[model samples]
Target chain A: MRYGGDNRGRLLIIVLLVTSLFLITLDLRGVQVIDGLRTGTQTALTPVQKAGSWLVSPFRNFLSDVTHLGRTRNQMEKLTAENEKLRLTLQNRKTADAQLKQLKGVLNLAGTAGYEVVNAKVISQGSTTSFTQTITIDAGTSSGVRANMTVLSGYGLVGVVKYAYRDSALVQLASDPAFKIGARIAGTQQIGILSGQGTRKGVLQLLDNTTQVRKGDVLLARGSQNGRPFVPGVPIGEVTSVDNSPGAVTQTADVKFYTNFSTLGVVAVVVSGSSADPRDSLVPPKPRPTPLPTVTIYATPGAVEPTPTPTATK
Target chain B: MSLRRFFYSFPIFFTVFLLQEAVVTQMRLPAGGINLLLVVALIWAALSTPEIGALTGFGAGLMMDVSQTSPGPMGHWTLVLIIACYAIAFLGYGDDNIRGNPINIIFLVTIGVVAAQTVFLLLGMMLGQQVGSVSNIAFLLAGSAFWTAIISPLILKVISFFHANIFGMRSQL
Candidate 1:
């Protein structure tokens, strides 16, 4: 009877090993059946994952708070003072913008670029077993999200949707080593391939080396011909440093992606783009000194030019 | 164990997988974070016969392969985990010193996770997947092993209590 256990196990292992080998072979060959299996699996587990995320969020936050206890306390103190000031301001009957900063910023960014977007919440982060950096979002095919579609935050490009199910989608984060995108220097035609190095920064290898890529130059997605993956003029990152190597046909530059994938809360999926490319229209405005506040109690319209509404709305 | 006895493990493994993906993965940890599912699966396998151990590994591997976050071809984790967990089962089988001791179980899990990941990396590279730099892989494995060891005691007690309830014993399969 004891020996029976070992024999049964050995036989089962052989069967399973063969099955796994078969599956791997077909998957590596890009078989449609395997893809279907993957999709089916994703579809089945997405709901469970979403529900688990909901249940796990409080615990996650507590752990996060514990890790950043000192910072949390400091923020608490700062927010308490800010709360007092906001309370006094609220007494004046002025309406406060209560929307999520990321959501509002994304909406404003889409408005600037004229891309119709479906806003979505980040449901969960990467899988524990997977080597890739990925995230699951609450939007999917029902919201017109398609595979290979561009996903972005208010700050800039987040990633591309690798798989889109009915109600949820898998996003390959921009920080994954497998992530790659075509980028162009802002205000110039110098295009290149930008690939992630598994960090906040990416490596941009300019296709044309003759055009001296300078430091601090901004990069934008060149956009696929049909825009299946990306839309033109979405800011990608800024060049931090350039590789200066001899006998090289291409020069690489280090760029820090504009969007911080770690802290992503609210993002938007571009269902469809505008008639125009909205070239350079979505570049995050440079930080400027806040205009001095004038205490003109009765001053209303045109008293002082408040930061000219970032762009003239359509 | 009979098929009925094994049925109890399916939901346990499933819940562990969900917790690993949903709660554990979301945490910003130093070396990628803990593989709660892997640790639990190994410990379960260690406490059981080789047959049950292989089954647990296969089931857990399928869950991992189906994950949306996995980038490699399907069945990679399955292939690696089955072998690793099967080996662990054999190592711990018929051995009281390894099964009854928390420290021994800790080492078993730590070694199991590291060995599985190492095999995964070699296989991934063979299949042309970009696994990352060698140093990065080393750091990730070390961190995973370190954290799993640190938490194995708590996991050991929890699993012990749960298994005692289900199997009617703590240290015997």
Candidate 2:
């Protein structure tokens, strides 16, 4: 509209753009000042974020319940008597029940592996701009959380701490494309490298082609030497599919992470690694296949066929 | 764009920023999550003149770049937003029909968000960052656009009213 020789606007944009590029270069060059700014911003804002989280979670849940009403309707009918009973625990505080379950799961996981962990509430999820999938936990150096420490939920590895401030830490979700961990197939020493693809899914490359990498095979973190980033025997994911190329040096598979990063409310940071690799002990029990009622079917010819249902892993 | 607006925006930006981190981040849809701060800022830009829009972008980008959850280097967002917001402002500025129509403004915002995201990804690739597969990028773009489209009208109204009151555009209100 005002295309009439806006010299000032042009000058402002040029100066800002140049400044932006310079800051980017400085950050890329691993400048300490940039890190300080980032740390300072987060540290300064953590308390405010925590307060907001407490105040806003209810409205968020209400909104989610409204938007997801249709999906929830479908699930409501499929709920088991046990889940129905659990749902009745607190009619007004159903979310608390779910969070309690998740909290227990995280604690049980840490307890099993003899990990010295700091349990933290996930105050935030991924960024608004979303350069990477991440979460901010309500734990930090004061709680013994450090950058590169393994962070896991009840289900499995959620991420590793990217930066720890005084009372909060930023976790880079395992689903980030940049996330990588050494992993092993459950019940075997077959090692591989797992990398994220920006979803719950990941890609794993086994070092050897001779060892079988089959569908449904459980994967676990193989532990770093000092266990700074990943600890041994934490369940990583299950192989969803595999690609076997004849001349390839390694085998690759599509892995679905055990932890659903989106719905995560609670997680734990392992301040210290386990004394020994727990191996496959942490592997979650696979859901047993439903058995066919052969006798009943034979007696009742017109009866419906057995329909397999996926049990809710929540 | 004025010192008065700057004084008013600091608290507004930080509040929206906190809400984004606390609540918006938790409601991640299957496609992608909404960037509340981005949408709000873009709407603010879309309703303003080029000069004001540039200033809005500068503030929003700083909040984006310095955010702890931000994975990109310090300036990627700043650079992308300044250009995108300025262009949006330039196109919609002084156009009564466009500014008066909520539909036009929302459409402008949806496009601006997508454009900014594309530029950000391209910049990321240029810097050797992993941006995921083409399909992933496409999904993210559509998600951002869809969410922004759904959310921008409300933001446009709020930002428009705020500007009218604070920037003294009583006639517009």
Candidate 3:
């Protein structure tokens, strides 16, 4: 009886130790385990998340209404002006309908493959202390919004879906410290990796200092290399200021996002598969260099084209 | 373990957690805001037996951790609260009858607030994250202590009344 009790205690200790070791290993690995755990948690908590969302929906709507009421008049005027301009542009474009359609078809074929946009309402926001800046949206599994879905607003790319439940999904915003987007300057075509600095404002790092870039330049998501995913030509933000650090090969700049997250009401979620060549389709083909004229001077008898005198000094 | 007692306690705990997450978190002083949870935990510890008080504190801390966005592992909070509760119970300053003693509640809550902040700082250090500078920590501790000292009397009175009237506990109040 004494031996059996001692053995049982030993077995219990061994089991506890092994379990702890496994957990520690899982924590150290980080990405794979966290991804799996988040997905599983999303799946398991789908019902609860949906219920919680529904419970908060009324409050969110009321708050949105009150906020929008303050700016309704200003927004209506802006919309009316925009409507007139768009109508005029549409009429002119229709006159060249065939040529425009052909161009659009060619551009669409070369650029984005089949993709569709879905709109989702922001439900809850992640707290300040949370590691990632994420927001829960109303669309989810039923809406075809899945993990890795790209989220955007009128301004540009907002984030990617980290996890999806039945009626809601968490989107890790582009402003999150861990987020990195491959981007390029719109005019200069200078490529760089845009990283979030965790400020209310964000910064993009240009890898090559030699690349000509300036403030007021627009940054666009130019896609990613390897199997990494990104949306092409999404307007990221405008460069507010540039910093050239001493002895560093790269220049960094602060980007002020056009999407005002503080007043974010409606946003569109783009449902698309990972593109192999996100940048390829978005970048306009380089303008063909103008052929240089070959200068040939023909010397006539009377012209006496300046005679080349070797050793004139002698 | 009575169903009635469980029902009453559940709402109190739930409300405390919700208030901590929402309102209290938003209340930022120049230094740091009040830790109402610590104040309540301390009052409970002072009014109960040492073992039970420690257990209650652990449960409260566990719930707080769950409702928080802390990067630390789970159960870290349980350990901190248990220690705070144990210290309060071992001091033996307040009595069961002293549950309604406003001055005594204020003194105990002040101590508990300091103790809780110290534990949080220690935990952050052990976890290899510098939450803030020493001056910032001291500012937070003093701020919370002052807030708790000012507010504990009214909270204690209400809590005592609930314990007596709703919980059917003997009128310590």
Candidate 4:
């Protein structure tokens, strides 16, 4: 009897293993049955996972803080005064900066590489070991965010939206290998394709061999035909290194992106608009139109003008 | 095969799973995070019958597959973990010394983790997924195995406590 039980147990293991393999094969074959099962499982579990994650966030933060207590304390000691000073300074500077940016936006409206901007906040980050760099944002279709829309930060281009859920969207970072953006060397017409390097950085390839690109040259997105994925003139990154040899037919350059994908916070989704150069916003606004001088004129009974008014002429 | 044992052991399994996903993954330790689920599987295989071990592994693997940040096809991890747990359970079958000894437990856990990881990576490669280069993958596997082994002693204590209190099992393991 014991022997029979042992045999049955072994048989069960074999069956489970084989069944799992069969399922894996079916899934690999693009079977909709397995896909549906997997999606249902995910959709059903996502809420629970979200709630668990939310509940654990404070614990995670506390744990992180505890782990870095010593370093944090030392840094705090050093930065306390600086923080206080900077807080006051930044408070004042923030208002000025807002005013400045707003004024610049208005002046550059004509030059705006026109794209409607919808702001979003990052909800959560993907796992560190995830195959692709992606993030979930709090804004979605309700906020005019849609798949393939370009996300941007104050510094530069961020990524493209991959999936737009009801109240959230998944943004595939520019560092993802699957992502590609048409880009150009800033200040020049030289165009290249910006492709992710699978690392934090990116690469601009397919530059004309004759085009000379120096390190530190900025890169800007080359808007698509419809300008949905990338609005033209949005800063992408800066050239870190140029790989052009004397006999090479094509050139490539490594790009150091201005926007840090890992620490993304508030971002703007390019919803719709005419593509305008973001760089134009940095230019000082044209002096406010000089207010037309108030002129007072009186007509005599014979409709004679004030011909004796030498002061008016002055 | 005792329903009571299975029912009692389940909460322990669920707790470990939550720890693996919620806490361990968030640690960001220098050597990368330890696979707590792998350690749990090792403990389950050591203490339980092959059938039970396989079931536990399958359940854990399925949860992992579904909850992965970038999910792949389901059942890949399930197969890997089942095979790993069953093999380990078979190796230590009816051997109280092997099952109860810390050294044996550590060795089994290490081997089980390496086996599961290698199979998973190979399967991923077969499916045209670019798991990193072999050398890097091997390094990661070794590192994770070592970490799992390092924490196995603590995990084993927790498992033993649950086994004694919840299941009322007097088995040595």
- Best candidate (score: TM-score): 2
Docking class of 2: medium
lDDT of 3 by residue, A38-131 (tens): 4554455445444554555444444444556666656445545777778446434532463344335333533353335667766556543323
By lDDT: ranked, best first: 2, 1, 4, 3
How far off is residue A198 in model 1, in Å? 1.8
DockQ of each two-chain model: 0.50, 0.59, 0.09, 0.22
Model 4 Cα lDDT, one tens digit per residue, A115-176 = 56777666555543324456666677777788888887766678888767656677888876
Best by lDDT: 2
Q: Rank the candidates by DockQ, best first.
A: 2, 1, 4, 3
lDDT of 3 by residue, B22-85 (tens): 4443322223446567677777666554554565566676565453233344445556677777
Give the higher-lDDT candidate: 1 or 2. Answer: 2
**Model 2 chain B worst lDDT run, 10 consecutive residues:** B164-173
TM-score of 2: 0.87
Candidate 3 local lDDT, residue B80: 68
* 10 residues in a row with least lDDT, candidate 2 chain A: A291-300
The parts of candidate 1 lying over 4 Å away from their true place are A1-9, A30-33, A66-73, A78-99, A289-314, B1-4, B26-30, B134-136, B164-173
Model 1 chain A — which ten-residue stretch has the worst lDDT?
Answer: A90-99
lDDT of 2: 0.82
